[model samples]
Target: MRKHWKSSAVSIAIATSLTLAGCSSGSGTNDKENVSSAAPSSQSSGGVSESGFPIVPEPIKLKMFTRIAPVNGPFKDMPVFQDYEKMTNIHVDFIEAPTDGFAEKKNLLFASNELPDAIYRSGLSPLEATRYGASGQLIPLEDLIEQYAPNLKALMEQYPEIRAGITTPEGHIYAIPGIVTLAAARTDKKWINKAWLDKLNLKVPETTDELYETLVAFRDQDPNDNGQKDELPMTARAGLSVVTMMSGSFGLDQQLGYNINIDNDQVQIWMGDERNKEMLMYLNKLYKEKLLDPELFSHKEADFLAKQGSGKTGFFFDQTNNNFLPIQDQYVGIAPPAGPHGDRLQAQTAPIARDFGAFAITDVNKYPEATMRWIDYFYSDEGSTLLRFGREGEHYVLKDGIPYYTDEYSTAENQPKITPYAGGGAPHIISDQVASYINPPQVQEAQKQLDPYMPKVKYGAPMFDEETAQRVNVLRNDMDKYYEEQSTKFIAGALGFDKWDEFQSTLKKMGLEELQQIYQEAYDKTK
Candidate 1:
């Protein structure tokens, strides 16, 4: 409701652990301090009060297992957490791991049964959240949200997708998500080189046929003006992910891979569909015609960036073309072209509630209510401002109603020393208003082309019950690999569509029907 994301079908993306930051209410206090700005009368004598500071009468310490973003300092050193400790009189022993190695360490902690009190920036998949939640390793959070999470509760009521995304089929909310309402932060951008388009006197393509004609013009004519046919009309690296972005134009929803799509409230596997075959045929045409990157399936990131840097790429995709620096100015974001059926959508763009496991309480936690209270503050506007932007007067200041970083805190050298205002994904609610404050102007402008096409009701990553998860996992482990291989072959012209019926039969034999059934069951409950 806050950003109106619930009006659409928002899929929950898997997000995990991240580390500490601080919030200041002007005064700083020791981590072990028992005093708070709020008077102690409103607080409970032995537990968390209904309102106010010093959540516990006596100082309490929580052990949190989290991972630090490379930009931010240790959680123990962050003034936000320190100031928070002072306000609540709750000391936390933050056990942090490096971003690169966090996943392994997090898994080990669970495997050893030596869990901390709670997890912050915890990167749990929907399946993992459901599995651990069902097993009682991660505690249920619905009751806690009802009692101690007024801000989160209000948001959930306003935006039901937030509730839908995190709630397990069995009715457990195992994790707290990091909410981002910025449109620019959501999807991989489709950037077309407008400079090239202008050189060839072409309008920006608005349909699949127009796009093909544009690519043909780009290939046949030297739009780059180098006099040699060196331009790559459309280029991408080795992955079906590019195809995922392109599939929406073909009237398919292929967001998070596995060729999974939903149509008319029913789960439909698109891998064997004729539409998918049509999409592949189009791709194969590009590959054979030399309009696509000849090494589409083998190029590394370095080579990909190098191509864009050379400024000869007619169309390509990326989260941001910041990698292509000065040359990126030649390009502008383009919405997906309409297909034969007038289907034009961006299935990839994310919802306001992006990360499903930014924070979670484990069964080992002793003060669940206090922890819930602690995290709930972040969902509030003021609390989110503090958590992400640092202090009002010191780190950033409001000028003409928009937040701007103080000169001292804005520098690259000092920015990371203070907090990760630049790097998000922490467990906080960053509205478009606040989130836009940090984006560079170019990124902000490019997203304008994509915003309108972002789907309102696209399905997201699915969660499963224990039995379903097991069976789904078994089928996916085998089928996913086989699917990738076969699909790549199909795209490369190694496997022809004449085997389309055989591919469908093979997928059914590999239990594709059961996989769709399990997903359908989980999906129906959300509605």
Candidate 2:
């Protein structure tokens, strides 16, 4: 039997101010009260005990929504959830949206006020979370964390940066972020065809000029030995393509083309910097020489993969070489090439290493306390390990304190299905504890090559004031479109470098300064 949440249930009536209500419950039909009565009452003044996992004495169900795994299956049938339920006595109803159009579906769910009890791998932007928390759509979790989530509280204390990264400018935490610290967090890495380098008798490139020469050698020397000029010096399919990695060499870490950088402790729009102009010019030269892929701007992922698979690409960029075809053995991760200005490192991401707001509780949940407690288990060391690696003998095996994936789990073909069950590729905290145990030999080898060049930065998502945030959104849209269009033209020779001054002027006209100012203010506030 089910009952409506009682009047005494704590409600986040945010049209007014942050307030709390009392919790009172009478008898229930079952031995344990269901979610309708249990969540609201237990959420206030410590509804659930602060004890460890298997949070509730009786099993309860909570509805959750998230992006579906690449492998098609019922979310309820996921082995990870089945194990979690067995361990914690909590059942979940999962609503999975396809990755391609998840945001749209999520927004529709929100707009319709048909929210689930919780959203896993929520993909909520900081601005969206802030806006929702400020309204009553999402509840702030400070109270729950302090009173009900010892594991999460300890995590915040141990990693103060995590607290700072997730807390809104208003000093409220609206979501639980996934914290992934591992070799993979190195983020952007450049991979070169090492076999090709050997064929041409060229060393790995250490500078932008050297990289260009290497590309030229690959193009002219017939490194693939097909005797036809078919080798693509470099290729990328993502929007940033190689730009995110290359711009850093020019002393302008213009990530995703926003051009935001810290100079003299202030947010500077690096697109306005002269060094960026040189970088563009250099890229144009590569484009003119046919070293960079001619279809760099328009090529689909399958097209790029075809070239790599056919041994026609000598240089590429990705988080790992393992993602490439069988020829991946020939590719090795290389440092971003140094520019004459002497910057040669991938720009570190914001402090929250993993996707922020990966997990968030919705306002509709009456069992915020129970929900927080259940989620908190995943943040604890033991629980985090379990979620990340799965049952020891079943999914992984330990030898000399290191856990390795079982034979069934080792291959990539098995990972899509296996990892989701282990929470490997899912949105959850994968701390050093998890990484240390689960990182295979190949990953460790890649880590050694990448660690030295990965500079760590502490910028989190910018928290703009409501008015400024709206303006920045408008300006950012126009700025990104204009930047991409102009840069492509210059690289493709459709627009000459003679129009460089006009491009800079256009950026200024598009409110580049105001955009930087808004970001600067937000950055300062974070400090």
Candidate 3:
């Protein structure tokens, strides 16, 4: 049902450019009567309608790829999708990739030109989107958004940064971003086992030393009270995230955070700083003393969550554990403990404009207009509600104008599996209104614990030009690999502290300064 995108050779660029330019640009004078408009035609556009349920007059199937956790079963078996198909008159041939190795598989799909009609839940980096869109592996969507996606159009007008964040150097929009408007949904909170602390007669840690001592107590005191040394004092999931989650105490952030500290509008990369060295030493101390989880670098999310929920995890960090683990009220969110130098920045804060690649169309699609109209639904309030809370009467019930999951889906285990938003792969808006309903009170209170220490000015992702994007990716690819390797060794004590200076020097030699300069230039342009 698809043709090879074969994006090789110089001639392909011209052909692709012509194809992109020739598509309707929403100029009223040149409107195609046969395409997504009144007049009927044989093209897939004939099935598409202007508005309402059954996005198309007739059934049409789109092949797309997205992530799936094992617990969620097959994507097609999802209740929302099962109901949504009847509502939309659209069938999705979902190519499900397991969440763990999905990234490597996604890369292979693009590299091998085994293009799906679209990519949903696509975590496309700005570089990947730009590179592919520029080369025509992915199609430009700005014109399509203008013509077909009223919901998305309204958002771009409402949040102008959405446009700025997703637009490419050549002024093409390759992907639709998932916007997170909820304040509490943004940052990772450092969660401590309040039950453990109370059992050990300990207060929440206030300083680095206090945290160290408390962890030691957790190791020796048998806080779980089973009289067995089975408690894991601290743990992480999906490998090295413990470092990222705890990095704020040392004054850095995680994931898409890129280790930046923008103080007084001066951008700096903290990877090479001596303060980071201190943080590494502290982590090493924890490692040597067995205060940290012995499986910190190797534990999977499933294992970690099971352990956290089992009443023996003294500490962990995540956006919210109330939904993931059964020990909801047992743990309390702690603010970043004061480091030796007293820097206690929260690890991350929600930026209005977060990830840009939520959904994208590849050039092989014959139904770009239909696809745009279908995906745009999630951007609307009604569509977002469906994606988040499912059909209101069935999945949730309204009580005093607030949506609450029914008893059948109320427990942590069932809610995560049954909620329409489970797996979190949809290209939808989770507005503050949605967050108010979905983020349990415990989660809300935990987020409050983090508010005072969060950075005053939370910087969103920087939009780099194509050339700068390429260079930054090149430098970051090498430097990030080296940093993670060396840092892990530093924490595990595989690398001696004497090599610390060598690590810093290696970072500098690997274009660390130039990387900072590029980000600085991008950051400045945002101002």
Candidate 4:
């Protein structure tokens, strides 16, 4: 990915050199001050010229740090950045790092006092944002946003809860948030082997009773036709599968902590809830009947994938069929199986519209107006599309005014070769709407398949307060470890229901009450 950005980096460097030479030639005087003076006018709607360019005195350069996926192509010289700089008339000095190295590099940069003018997708936690904002290391964008960011301001007006969610208790927003409109497509869906269903002549299981019967048939009938009795009805990577889609079937929230709604006002821990015990009992019955995978608790993702690829498992939960079946035609996505209690639950983990991964201006920036104006352009439909898809006719083409990715840039065969195009850049630089505008046909089809199922899913709790977040983070970690350990023992028949009280005692001793209290308070604050 770094190789793909070479051209863009070279272009930026050339532009910077030309700007420097022009400055040295005395063609410009007080360039910074002049640019700064043009800032306020740009805040108004009529400040930009008909060409959609801000009426700033001269172009100003700003530094930025960002990360890209390893397969996303090279960063420094990518044509996307070059095109962005050329079009916006704002040179961006970018420090592009690979995704794996992003967190470490960002932390080092902050720790070493070598911060850039702005950070995009820095992956800083909410806690880090609060700490940095409080320390003045990061500037609150509330004033700058009001004065210079009309697009962002309008976005806030449309989603006021989002504004409140990201706003600090002191009434300042420390970071800009990524916007995602649909939340339902974010949950893990129950995928079953359609081939196996056909082999057994079984319709898709909608109820828990039907699912159990189907699993029993798969276990005994050997739907794979392998002749061996080596079939697992369902297999999951233990802790990963213990959440909402599965546990919610028993009328219990799958997620831990303050997000679990006891009533309208109360937040409680799901583990201590009686519904959880019932869920455990049901799971134990599956274990006793040999319907559950024996090695599930010990399996890694790779192990699960191996099982999936081998066609040994009948059903499992995953974010998408793409994770297990590359051939979308082969599998079926069924609604989560209903429990005995008639609860047909779905998991909702949609990306928040204003919860982080947005661009922000820094106090250290010498050209705030130029920077804000250039960034604000990204909010425009045209500008957003350009950032997301690349230059028209180069990365994409228009048909009847609907944008589509060009074959040369969108096909799997051309992906590596198309690195020079701007479509490969970080998503944080653009909006989801823009990306969807130029998405490949296959991607568009997949999204359509997933969209209708989204509304059926439910979201977890709101974000907890700082202190509560820290405590829940700690408690969840411990709780998960305990769950994993105890769950494995119970499923393997090493621990029995006779010792259920003992397990409860152990959880209480591990500070479960303290953890629950912290979450309850945070949940109240959100309300």
What TM-score would each prediction reach against the true structure?
0.83, 0.85, 0.84, 0.74
TM-score of 1: 0.83
lDDT tens digits, residue span 1-527, model 4: 00000000000000000000000000101111112122333323333322244334355566777665544565445555677665545666666666555556666665665667776545455556665677676778777667666665676676565565566667777766655443322445566778888998999887778988888998999887989998779877655365444765665552211225344445566665566667777777776788877776677767876776666778876644434444545566676667777765453344334235355545566655555556555555565556555668887787766556686766533443334222232223234445543333433444454454333222233344455556656766777679768866666678887888888888898888887676556445554
lDDT (Cα atoms) of all candidates against the true structure: 0.71, 0.64, 0.70, 0.55
Better of 1 and 2 by TM-score: 2
Off by over 4 Å in 2: 1-49, 254-258, 302-311, 348-350, 421-425, 436-439
Models sorted by TM-score, best on top: 2, 3, 1, 4
Evaluate model 2: give its lDDT: 0.64
For candidate 1, write residues 395-507 as lDDT tens digits: 88987665677878755446666654334457877765565344557666767777787766545565566677677778887778778888888888899888888988998
The candidate that wins on TM-score is 2
Judge candidate 4 at residue 246 and give its lDDT. Answer: 70
Candidate achieving the largest lDDT = 1
* Winner of 1 and 4 under TM-score: 1
Give a tens-digit lDDT track for model 3, residues 204-313: 99988999999999999999888899888887776567676777777665312477666555678889888788888989999989998878788767787787677888
Better of 1 and 4 by lDDT: 1
The ten-residue window of minimal lDDT in model 1 covers 23-32
lDDT of 4: 0.55
TM-score of 4: 0.74
